[model samples]
Target: MTGGTYTLLVEVPEATTISVGALGDQQFPAGWYAYTGSALGTGGFGRVDRHYELAAGDRETRHWHIDYLLGHPESRIRGDVRTPDSDIECAVASGLPEGPVDGFGASDCDCESHLAYAETGAELQTAVADAHRQARSE
Candidate 1:
């Protein structure tokens, strides 16, 4: 396994299309996330924190399919960092030191790092939008 982990921001009540089989009922309305067991850049925790801090700004808002499933009002983060063993995480670990991530929305591109420093509500919205756009495109 690779020495990497994924941080994800999922919306509550949203169903994530993670290759980890099925989320079942443990769905999140809206929040940041990092899949467990995957190598991450310098500020892995900081990046995910930006997606949660309410003051992160609007740019970090939710927009991906999982976020859409979560919808509005659910953007409020509801849980702590969760680590699950899934195919997605496993895949990510397989390719460490690659600089870019495979299953991650903002993998190796700008989209992935732009939200690393969500400091205001507006920035959060924009960051979320960026991830959402990336998710949709993929």
Candidate 2:
């Protein structure tokens, strides 16, 4: 499968809490978020497409922890950084600043969390890009 790692830059306009499936209720501060994930399965990058759909309110199924956050009314996808043909999800996630919500989108890995938060979209976007670049270099 031609899969890779990707970081979705999400924005939360207002602070709120959402129920993340088995993760239960979690707090989310108002800010920009970077969620790193792997698309190494047979569907490959299709998973990223699904995330956008969910964020756009086109989809209702919540299969991942990120979905819960993205499904929130005030949350939307700002952009994404992708490292094609690379499985550096964990590396990229660890490269960015730590996320406040523990275990978000990190059910399968050893990462503290696959989600990072920043007070501004620009800052989070830059961090996500840097993480992707660093992961690619490594």
Best by lDDT: 2
**Global CA lDDT of candidate 2, please?**
0.89
Indicate the TM-score of model 1: 0.29
lDDT of 1 by residue, 11-48 (tens): 33332332211222333223343222223555544544
Off by over 4 Å in 2: none
Collision pairs in model 2 = none
Error of 1 at 70 (Å): 7.9
Local accuracy of candidate 2 as per-residue lDDT tens digits, 1-138: 467999999989898988889989988899999999989889998999999999999999988999999899999898888888998999999989888888888888778999998999988888888888888888
Model 1 accuracy (lDDT, Cα): 0.34
